[model samples]
Target: MCSLAPHPFLSLSKPFTKRTLISLRNVIRDSALNKPGILADSSASPSRDAAVLIPFCNVNDVPGILFEVRGKTLRSHSGEISFPGGRIDSTDKSFLAGALRETREELGISPNRVEVLGELGPTEVNLRGNMRVWPYVAFVHGHQINEKGTLDTPLSSIDLEDVWKHRSLEEVASVFHLPLQALASPVRLKASKFRGGWPYWAVDVSDLVEAEKVEHGDGEFVDEVGCGQEGRIEIWGLTGWYLSLLTRILQIHS
Candidate 1:
């Protein structure tokens, strides 16, 4: 007892020692935050760094994409269906890290498990102010939902399996039910000379059917065209830009 009391201050590091394990974890986290590089896109504002992860998996044995409906509490694009992502953190190693971290936080996905395919085009939005959004694609072969019935507070989830998988162009047409025609692809994007700082870019959906027909064919693949605000397909705004990029990728892949 006397020997034990004398040596009380000295002890072997025990398994799962709180201090040692916690300190090790912190070291790993710190290292990860220090990596990543800058963007080549001048449109990408370093002052307001952000990124988003668009995840896809095999559904109905076909590629299925994941989109999130933003929470109504969000300032601008509240309740809009989109990808999972947020602003870049000082601790983030790079844009990719920021995106992965945001996805894990928002959707309870393990970042390590995401096989990053690569980065896609970036979209800029003027929401109350200005934002530069970078999108990355990743393949999630395996996913597990937490105790909850779904992952996080899903605004709504749609499985493309029976709903849309392998459906003919006729099915696509019937779903949106918008007028289809061969309209010249609208110059969807334009850039203006920067008089002072960054150059400004403009996007217009003046030609919706034309854009859709660029891939779907002349009223052959699609059923209808959404018009005014009542239509299911919105051809203007940030969502439109995202759809444009997605269409391009799909066309190339197909």
Candidate 2:
């Protein structure tokens, strides 16, 4: 795996699997050891049970993180960019188990097939402390195509299992693996005010998967933001905050 400190990337740097991805894994593992069995930002107890997995993977030797576009009909956070996870059930052995279960349900990637790296610092779901979400970092085996038609991950690792099998217009619209090269770029994510009040991060879907090396379907564009829609697709709010924390650990993005 590649080893390098934080630095500015010009274009898509090298394959992240051969670059910073390994470094990030090491950092997350070390951080977990330094902390407790699970990571939380505050000691206050939450009233609800929910967890999310910040899944990482080496798709065809290129490293990236997995994300999902929630179906527009979900009870909460509909049509938003999110990780593969949901409410922790009463039968779940732990928060990690809930996270893995959701991952299996959302992407069809089995639990045993993933290597859990560690836990990311948990955050309050509503900023009011009533509900908190514990996020896990892991390496999963699979690939997927984004809405704009970029086959970032092989549809079945190109064959074994179709990662998009669970997708439906009312559930998970699409899955995407945001490459580390664009992730490491300064311009990849921009800080902006959401709803004219909350400060958050936003990235144009085009800039995220626009590298010439990105494979596309016969001149298909790489922008998932404008799917004939009027608004932008942002990695902001809770998802964006966690990403900020992850990038800081990898020391790749400012």
Superposed Cα deviation of residue 117, candidate 2 (Å)? 0.3
lDDT value for candidate 2?
Answer: 0.61
CA shift of 22, model 1, Å: 38
Instruction: Name model 2 segments beyond 4 Å from true.
Output: 1-25, 32-45, 142-161, 193-200, 206-230
Q: Pick the candidate with the highest lDDT.
A: 2
What tens digits encode model 2's per-residue C-alpha lDDT throughout 162-243? 6667544465766777777667655546766533554445554553322223237897655432121234565766777777
Clashing pairs in 1: 35-93, 173-222, 173-223, 177-224, 178-224, 178-225, 179-224, 179-225
Instruction: Count backbone overlaps in model 2.
Output: 1
Predicted model with the maximum TM-score: 2
Clash-forming residue pairs, model 2: 2-18
User: lDDT tens digits, residues 103-153, model 1?
Assistant: 766655567656565566544544433467777766544443221333222
Instruction: Return the TM-score for each candidate structure.
Output: 0.47, 0.70
Report every candidate's CA lDDT.
0.43, 0.61
Clashes of each: 8, 1
